[model samples]
Target chain A: MNVLEIRGLSVDYLSAGGTVHAVDDVSLDLRRGEILGLAGESGSGKSTLAHAIGRLLRPPAMITAGSVVYHRKDEQVDVLKLAPKALRAFRWKELAVVFQSAMNSLNPVMAVGAQIDDVLRIHEPDMSRKARGERVVELLRRVGISADRRKSYPHELSGGMRQRAAIAIALALNPEVIVMDEPTTALDVVVQRDILHEIRTLKDEYGFAVIFITHDLSLLMEISDRIAIMYAGRVVETGTAKELHRSPRHPYTLGLLRSFPKLRGPREDLLGIPGTPPDLRDLPPGCAFHPRCQSAFDDCGRVSPRLLPGPHGEVACLLNENTGVEVQA
Target chain B: MRFLARRLGFYLLTAWAAVTLNFLIPRMMPGDPVDLLVARLKGNVDPAAIEAMKQAFGISDANLWVQYVDYLGNLFNGELGRSITFFPTEVTTIITGALPWTVGLVGVATLISYLLGTLLGVLAAWKRGSWLDGVLPVSTFMHAVPYFWVALALVFVFGVTLRWFPVSRAYGLDVVPAWDGPFVSSVLYHAALPAITIVIASMADRILGMRNVMVTTLGEDYVVMAEAKGLTSRRVMWAYAARNAILPNITSFALSLGFVVGGSVLTEIVFSYPGIGSMLLKAVENEDFPLMQGIFLVISLAVLVANFLADLAYVVLDPRTRQEA
Candidate 1:
């Protein structure tokens, strides 16, 4: 069942010069208890989309036209239309965001427990202070921190500990959806694996859909139920994580998977997608990805491929026409 | 605490150096201050009376080192010595009499100005491209206009033309010298022009300083975290951004406090206010060595102590400072 559905969303950033179409027309969904990994390079607007769903997008980054409908209890509610008080009430209780650079996200002055307690106080104002503290301690323990360390300031914790504290804060309200934006980007490989394991365990125990945005496709393959590849503010491809891993259709997706340095394989030199992404403001012709696509043609330059039905998945590529089976669906 | 003790020791040593310089600079001048005073007084001063006055003033030197030692010894005992210009009055009494006026006037005004400027600066930063940005340029213009010039203009408009407040002096001559409501009100009323002039001149730089800091701080990943957590704009503004932005402003406020005794010479002169600045001016005009030395010592000491307190305040203001500590 779809837990979060984003439709016809386009976010424009207002600057001194003019509006920057940061996120062009895009739509996607997150299934209940499923991890939807949205993969993209920097400036691909994946972060903007993630921020938009959480209603965390600040001024100058206007959500021009779209609906971010969150499904809870079989009822669809547009998040953008919520009043300030209603939005805040919904935010921590029903939706939480584990932002990028999670290590630095914890308040330096406040203790980990107090920060978690703050979320509880804001969201569950009815909870007694003592009860809130107990819950926070329990949350911290679940996230793998010693209960006593809850009183310690954020600086007392290591980078991994801080990330854990941030995650714990997000989990404080037991929200239906948790938006993890590069949550493990700042952690070491071993810690990243450990945190991801903890998250998987937490998801199993508590059950919240996650919209995970990251650059690491390999990492996404390990955890995400499905994956979406974004380029120049649009989803180029998306499918079940297993299907996308085995038979990726979009060249950019294939290129990205090939680019990952495999440790055990008899590897040819890792193939990197040549040329930088086209400037979003000055996108070349029709396809933003055409300049980087090795299999570009006149038609590729004239038309932007939608993420249409393909074999076992959705893929946006001009080459899909020649590959008839994937296109027929 | 040990580190703090070491810092305190170093500050005290530097302040001692200042006090020593305070004593020496005046005495080292080309002519004897006593001789100059006597010459100015011309035959009204007897040779015997002059000698007696010199001895009493601590200028009848046994030796340079001996005099220096005595000077330091006297300073330890709170003997700033009497001001020759304001004859028969101790320097300590004069400073005590003048300090409350300067502190009451400039201190309150500076506090209000700094707080107002910092708050406005934070507001401007939060709404970066709005009309609030326009405020800084006007404030900067006011700041750029010399303190004396602003003072003169205020005195001209408010003092000479409007007659809203007294043109000069802190209190009316008819009022008995007590900290009563009318006296206090009169002092505040008369001080309004100079206080405002100082506020206008200094507040812009403070606003600009805080605005720059706030703008930089707003970009920190933690602020993004706060925003992502759905904190209200005001909470994010005050609790997060303003808390960090106000640290530098607090230090600036402390420095302004340190210089409170020095007063703004131009503003003091413009209003003929009986603050230290005007007193120092008169001392300079008369070459009152002891008075100059005493005032300079007090000003320097105030500055050093204020800076020390500012450094201590850093731990409270910025968590980073405490975490590192």
Candidate 2:
């Protein structure tokens, strides 16, 4: 069962310089209680796509065209069409987001516990003060923070603990879908692995689906059931972790795979992608990755390939047109 | 608690330095108050009369150190000495008479300005790019305008032309001075114009300070996190954005509180309001050493106390400060 469906979503940032197509037309789905990893470089619009799902993007960054349909047991909600008041209620109770740099995302002036309780106080008002207090303690405890640290401010907590606090706040209402955008990007490797392990534990306990976005493909491969690679604001390829590891058809995905060094295997030189991404405001005609692709040929510069799905999963490249068997764009 | 003690210790040292400067400044000035008084008489004055007057003024030739010790001792005993401007009337008595007027007028006006401006600022940032943002340019202009000009403009339009409010003094001369309702009402009636001028001239600072910070804070990751938590707009706006935005404003408020105690000299002088500002002017003109020292001492001490209070407030409002000790 699908928990969320994003169809033909596009996001643009309007500035005096020009309108930046931050998130070009994209589509994907979040299955019930599954981890969906979105891998991309900084400007690939993965974060923008995540924010658009929750309708959390600020002004100047508008959704030019899209439909974010959130599926509940009884009905489907068109998130972009919800009114302002309904939108407020729909956010945390229906969908929660662990924003990038979650460590610095807790209010500095407020106690971490109060921040978590605030979500409950608003969405679950029928709960008593004592009940809410107990819930906050439990939330903190689940995140491995002691009850006494509840009164401590964000500055007093270590970076790892703050990130956990942010995640705990997102899980306060236990919504069906949680969007975590680079949730561990700010922490060191040691703490990052520890938190990632805890997240897996918590995910099993809560049974909530996650849309995790990150630029580190290696990290995503470790936890994601399926991985989607984005480039120039478009998803270039997507497949099961095992399928992508076995054979990456998209040249961009091939380069991304080789960008990271392998510790377990014999030493090999990291082959990073050749050039930077094209500017969103002025993308060249044809395949956006043609200029950087090592296998670019005459047709690669003349045709813009669409993401085609087949038995091998999805790949958006002109070279894969003749790969055969039931391919659909 | 240890942080508070450190903070308090800093204030105490500041007070001592302020009092010392207050004592040294007038003594360093060109002529003694006694000479100025005798010069005003414009006749052959008896040397005995001058000597007697010098003794009464707390001036002595027993060496500068001896006089310094005497001044410190007298300050402890609450013996600020008699004012040359109103000789035989205690300097302490003259100051006490003016403190209430200044406190009432400037303090209340600053309060009204800060509250009204800060509230509008938060609203403007919350509904950013809305009509409420119209306040930004207006506040910028008001903040740039000469403060006294705003006062005079109000005086001309409202007091002189429309004849709406009383233009001068703290209260009407016809009213008997007392704690009765009528007298209190009369005081308020006359204070209206001056208070309005203060608000108009000064409210812009509070508005811009708050609005700009609020706009910056609204961009913070935490505010966005709060919204994503599905908290109401009100909860996210106040507790997350405004609460943090208000920290910078608190320090500004405390410093402005010091300004209230220091008294607005132009506001006092323009309306002939009898506050410390006017008294300080008189003391300087007459070289009333005791009165000058007394006013200086009050202004500096008030500033130190106000800053101390701001520091104390930070410890409560921000855990970062409390972590210092």
Candidate 3:
């Protein structure tokens, strides 16, 4: 069963000059106990999508239109429509997000343990202090941090450890889905591997789903059951990790896969994407990716394409239609 | 603990330097305190009385270094010499008599302004588009107006015209100054206008200061994380945002507390209140070197003490400050 059902969600950053279309008409699903990898380049709105899921977008960056239905057991609630009181309960209880750059995620003044304990105390007001204290230690240990490190502030811990502490806080209330936005980007490769391993082990043990958002496609390929490629604030492709890797349909996804050098393959120079992502404030008339696409035609510049169903998954490029490989969904 | 000792040592050095400046500046000026005293006496005093007056005021043929030693010795012994402004009265005695009223009235008034302003500023920043934004312009106006204008306006409106409060003095003319209720009420009644003036004039800086900082910290990642953690708005505001934002304000607050020893001179003068401020003015006007030096010493020491206290508070408030401790 799907834990989170997101449909046609759009986020716009309203500024003095003009509105920046950050996230536009994106829809996805997170099944129970599965890692759904959200892959994109830097300005592809990966973090925006994650923030939108929790309704954590601040002023300027507003949800122009969207509906995020969080399903738990038999109950369903549109996260966007929750009242302030219900919204407070909805966050960290049903959906917790570990933000990008862990150095800034946790409060610098508060102790690591105190920050973790905050989530528990707020969500479970009637939980005893002793019980909360014990849970903090357990959570810390679960994330591969020593119990003694609890008293240390965010600065006191290593970068990887700080990220782990953030995860521990997210895992405090045992939420059904955890949205991790570049949670391991700040750490070294070895530490990142360790954290990803810990996350997988914990997910296996707890059976909680994870929406992992990152620009690192290789890491996503290693961990994700299914992968969604976002381009210019919209998901351009969606497929299983192996299927997308072996035979990616989207041209943008193909360029991304080609950008990363394979360890075992014959030596070949990397071909990074030709141009930067489009200006979010003033996007192209039809297809945002057409200017950079090698296969762009007259029709490609005049019309946007929807994600059409295929054998592996779906692709939004009109090439699939021209080739007569798949029909529109 | 080491950091505390280090800080304490630094303050002691500053305190010594302040005391030396206090002792030197008054003497460096052209006129002598003995001359001022003799002029006050109107030539009636004899040469012998003049010598005695000079001796009482610590004027002697001793070299500057020896006199400095003597002054330091007198300070260590807690004897601040006689006040020329209030002749025959010990400077220490005069300060002791005046300090309680200043501390009780101006100190508490300034504190109230800080607390109320900071609270309102936090609310204003938290509710950016709410009616609390209306409080911002008023804070700016209060900040812009001169302290004395507010004091005089309040005195005219609340005291002279309205006849709601006493026109002058720290207490009623008929009420005995004591630890009793009637005397205390009279003191508070008289202080109301001056206190309101002080608050109105000063609270703006704090409100503006705190609001600017709160606006900045409210956008910090930690505050967002706190909110995402399902914590209440109050906890997110005070604990995560306001707590951090208040750090800079706390330093200024401590400095203001130190300035409380100097008292609100203009306000005190306008209200004719019995406080250190009026005495300080009188001392300056009379060129009462001993009293001026004494008041200056107290103010400097209070400032040093306040800075030390602020350092202690920072160590408690920000965990990073304890790194060297």
Model 1 Cα lDDT, one tens digit per residue, B1-325: 5546666899989998998888778778776768878889885898898888887677775877888888889889999988889887988888888877777777777887888888888999999988888987897797778778777877788888998878798878878777799877777778777788788878888888889999988876677766666677787777767776677677787788798778656667888888888889998998887788888998999899888888788766655665534
Among these predictions, the greatest DockQ belongs to 2
Backbone clashes counted, model 1: 0
Output the better candidate (1/3) by lDDT: 3
Residue runs of model 2 more than 4 Å from their true location after superposition: A322-329
TM-score, every prediction: 0.94, 0.97, 0.96
**What is the Cα-based lDDT of residue A221 in candidate 2?**
84
With a 3 Å backbone cut-off (N, CA, C), the pairs that clash in candidate 1 are none
Q: How far does residue A200 in candidate 2 sit from its true spot (Å)?
A: 1.1
Q: Which regions of candidate 1 fall more than 4 Å away from where they truly are?
A: A16-19, A263-268, A322-329, B42-46, B129-134
RMSD from true fold, candidate 3: 2.3
Candidate 3, clashing residue pairs? none
Show model 3 residue runs off by greater than 4 Å: A261-264, A324-329, B39-45
Candidate 2 Cα deviation (angstroms), residue B39 = 1.6
lDDT value for candidate 3? 0.88
Q: Which tens-of-lDDT digit does each residue in B178-230 have in candidate 3?
A: 89999988888888888888888888998999999999999888998898888
Give Cα distance to truth, residue A309, candidate 2, Å: 0.4
